[model samples]
Target: MADYPILAVVGHPNKGKSSVVSALTQNDQVHISPLSGTTRVAQHFSLKLDGETVFELVDTPGFQRAAKCLAWLRVEELPADQRPARVAEFVEQFRSSGQFFDEVELLKPIVAGAGIIYVVDGSLPYSPEYETEMEILRWTGRPRLALINPIGGDAYVAQWQQALNQYFSLVKQFDPLHASFDQHLQLLRSFGELDSRPGRIFDQAIEQLEQYRRQKLEQAARILVENLYRLLTYQQSSSRLEQAAREQLPELLPAEISRFNQHLNWLERDGQQQLEALFLYHRLESDLARLEVRQSELMDESQWTLWGLEKKQLVLVSAAAGATLGLLADAGLGGSSLFAGAIGGGVLGGVSGWLGLDWFKQQLPAWLQFSAEQHLLGPVKDPNFAFVILGRALSHARAMLARSHADRERLTIHQAGDHFMQSLEMKVQIRLLKQCKQLVRQGPQGQAAEQLRAWIYQQLTA
Candidate 1:
């Protein structure tokens, strides 16, 4: 039972309570409104790891009848110990009463044994009026903490912190919209410090949350591996036709390339959805348009600056891949053979085809044999283009990692000081690039697939 702690997030209307829950749970589905009293009832969101619940967060409607509720509780007709019963009596009388409905909804969970996590807008000046609400919560005699969430700026944080301390046993400041990964954990750890609740399970909650974080990173790595494989190896073909129809091939071919490129773009969008869902930000649409990593086109120059490798790095890896193919070609021809001239041309062609290949150049596959009936394109070419695919994937993953789950602002990724691929070791980069090339050639087997997954995992998370 200690493994599950129920926390009720309560506050005044429009004070960013939903934002706090969203950030803590990494869930974007919670509705947040600027208008007063958006959440009219209590909503429960649970944090689960491996299909089991770790902790639950209850987002309750904000206080509406604090003054009246406090006024009723202070009648003094009831003894000190009986005040809790008075509070309960008030709920029984007004649970469905129109004016006190919001207050009742917010207080129901606290009366039921959930710990209180009171939220306040630190951006607003601290006032005496909210004391009525705090006094009402205190009358319930539940374990409680105060959260000073700065919705706009921190000009009043010091004041909010000072005033909140007198009422709540613990007072902490959190900016739900901008809090970092560490701040989320620290806030949860602070909840474990409440004195009223014995056998606190926050330590267990923290452990599960951390494990969930690493598992999410692993999911992102798998996405890069499998999606990159399909995209790099995607192939399409059209049989060449003779006669008057042959002239129309020009129009049909470019359209085919466009269609294939569109498919790759579809893969990217699908991947974005997967990563967002993994972290529980399922409702928010990606704000990729104005960011540095935005891809206006598959190989847009702007994206290249953000996710592409340096030209020199691409050249070195490409040269190594070419050399490897050359050795294979030479080995295929036996050692003691002067009759090798017959196949010598084939060897030079193979080596030069790899060395001089632009990978990015818009050309139909040279492998397309002009047999009486065929023309084919794709199985995306090597290193440079593979880097292009990888660069975009990495940029998207990093953006999702850095964003606060509660942030609704248009998704934007500022350029990392350097390219994402630039951080990997040279050999890792080469091996990864070669793997992309191999996928294009024969597809990944069990061993190769695991190697691909490991390399992608390192680049994404290491």
Candidate 2:
């Protein structure tokens, strides 16, 4: 237990104590509130890797009667060595008195050999009013570290640091709301500096934590690649499609596309949920736009061009990937009737190699096909659709990675950032287009899926 290194996080009322615990332990279920006295009892949270405890954090209620409790400790003249025993006696005497319940609960772990983690709001000016609480922690004879949490802003961080440095062995500024993963590892390394006995354990925990993060990223890439294949090649059929007359399809098509959109959204959401769980986010909601296909067309310019490649890039990539001159004609290019093989050439060149929107409208029968004598509604045929799926996935993954577990806001996948796929080298883009072709023709179980997964993993790590 001594080598395990339990840390008791104590602070003033309404400070970001629970937020610190949530951030450090990577546990979101910890209760957090702006109201004072939200944490009534001490709760233990452990960061475990493969069922082995790396370390533990104790979220304890803030001090309620610090000045009065310090008064009692000073009733008798005591040497520094005897102070800890006196603090223990106070806990024993007031165990059930209900007079100093918060103090007793907060000190229980410290008395039992847990180190101290004192939290303060650096957004407010430093005051001597906090000394009583700080002095009592010093008397407990445990290694102490003070955290200046800038809950609102860092207006008074230097002020807080000057005072905290005099009270604790180590002091740091940490914002649980927005700290990055590298900052997390740095904080853990500082925890190892508190004492020599538990230093080895903390080092091991840091190594394992880094390895665990890499594994999660790899798993996330797999999820994205698999989901992309499913969405691109997805097909749905119902008795309604078979029963409807050919003329009725125009009217019936919109409803079927709506259903197809719902299923595609469902598939994408399922992948997102798996990613959330992989990263230990149990209640994450992504605010990405719904996937849709209107009248056998890709989404409008605002969405299609922003998330996927721009139309010009699409044309260049398609031409580079061996699309025929006639396929280029369909992507808003003017041509006579001489190049009639454009549609057939585009189909043979593969979906990622050409913009066949005119051909798309002229060929609804291509998407709504009669295969195996059954009318099947989709597996969207647009070349740019693959890029759209990949772009959205990269955006969502980056957002989840950048988020802190303590963040309570809904995860919004903003389209404001530069699209990753849009910035890739032309050669890589060509290779990706080729992979999309393989996935469409062969599904997710082949060599193409493996190559795509590797490429995605590289992007995530980069």
Candidate 3:
């Protein structure tokens, strides 16, 4: 226990103490409330890697009787070396006293070898009243760091920082709700500086944490890609049923289409949930104001306009894919060059544009197919369906990653710019679009999807 570094976050009532713990641990499940004194006792959070504790953080109750506790300790002129024991004695004596319950709970961790992480609400004015808590922590003689956390808009932080530096060995400003991953990591590394004994352990733990974050991002991308493969190739057909059921195809067909759409929705929702978990978030809220209008809305009018490539980008993608097909056709026709193949693709594309997308969708096999008595709705074979699914996935991933663990803030995507697809290089755009098209039409292309997965991983890290 002595070797394991424990950080006990001690502070005044409602000063974002639990928020700091949540940010550092990346655990949204930590209870947080606006009211003061929400945490009645010290709750230990052992930061772990594969079930092995790397370090510990204790979210302790705010001090309710710091001045009283400090005065009682001063009643005895004990030697400097004996102050820690005196503080522990005060907790022992007051355990049965309800007046100092909060003080006793907060001090238990420090008495048991946890280093102090004193939190102060820097948004408010600095005052001498806080020194009672600071002095108690100093008297314990354990390594200490003071955090000036802004809980509101008006940040009079300079005075808070100056005051904290007087008592604690290290002082820092951290916004528990909005700090970036880098800031969280840097704070953890700073904890290593508090004491020489815990320095190496903190270093090793931070190293593991960095690797873990990267792996989680990759894992999320893998999930998205796998789901996209399924959605693109998804098919729902109705056959081998009673003649009465088959004769009711007029009414039954629309139901099948509705069910297929529902399936896609479920797939997207599942992917979003999986992404949230990979990012270590159990709670997510939508941001209506910041998200692209199309993205924020439901799929009624197909809100993929800002998430997917525009019509021109699609034309280029189609041309590229069609060129590949035409080149093979040309080779079969005994042509030595791809020039004829390129012309063939151009004519094919022009014909498609003239035919309209909906007509092409209807013409594709396995979609609205009919026999003497048998009929089918779809595992939509339209390549555009793949693009639509991919767009939704990308939109969901971007929104989730941007604000997945954000405290008290809703998720949003700024839609002032071009679609995410437009930001990619032409080759990647074409490759992704073509891959989706191929997967939907031919079904489950391992090699193409693997390449797309690698691309997605790169995009996420970048």
What are the RMSDs of all candidates, in order? 6.8, 5.0, 6.3
The lDDT, on a scale of 0 to 1, for candidate 1 is 0.69
Candidate 3 yields a Cα-based lDDT of 0.67
- CA shift at 162, candidate 3, in angstroms? 1.1
Ranking by lDDT: 2, 1, 3
Top model by TM-score, which number?
2
- Assess each prediction's global lDDT (C-alpha) against the native: 0.69, 0.76, 0.67
1 or 3: which has the higher lDDT? 1
Runs of candidate 2 with Cα error greater than 4 angstroms are: 286-301, 322-364, 441-445
Candidate 3 lDDT, tens digit per residue, 342-380? 223433322222212222333432255555655554444
Better of 1 and 2 by lDDT: 2
Q: Is candidate 1 or candidate 2 better by TM-score?
A: 2
Q: What is the lDDT of residue 128 in candidate 1?
A: 92
Candidate 2, 1-462: lDDT as tens digits = 655668999989878889988988888888888788978889999887777777899999999999999999999899999999999999998988988999998998888888888999988998999999999999998888898999889999998888888888899999998988888888888877986562487788789889877888888988998899988888888578778776776677667766776787778777877787888886574333232222123333445465746666765766665353233444443332112322334332222222233334345445566644687766765555687778877888888888888888777665566767778888888788778878877777888988998989888877
lDDT minimum window of 10 residues, candidate 1: 334-343
Clashes of each: 1, 0, 1
Could you tell me which residue pairs clash in candidate 2? none
TM-score of model 3 relative to the true fold? Answer: 0.83
List the pairs of residues colliding in candidate 3.
Answer: 235-379
Q: By descending TM-score, how would the candidates be arranged? A: 2, 1, 3
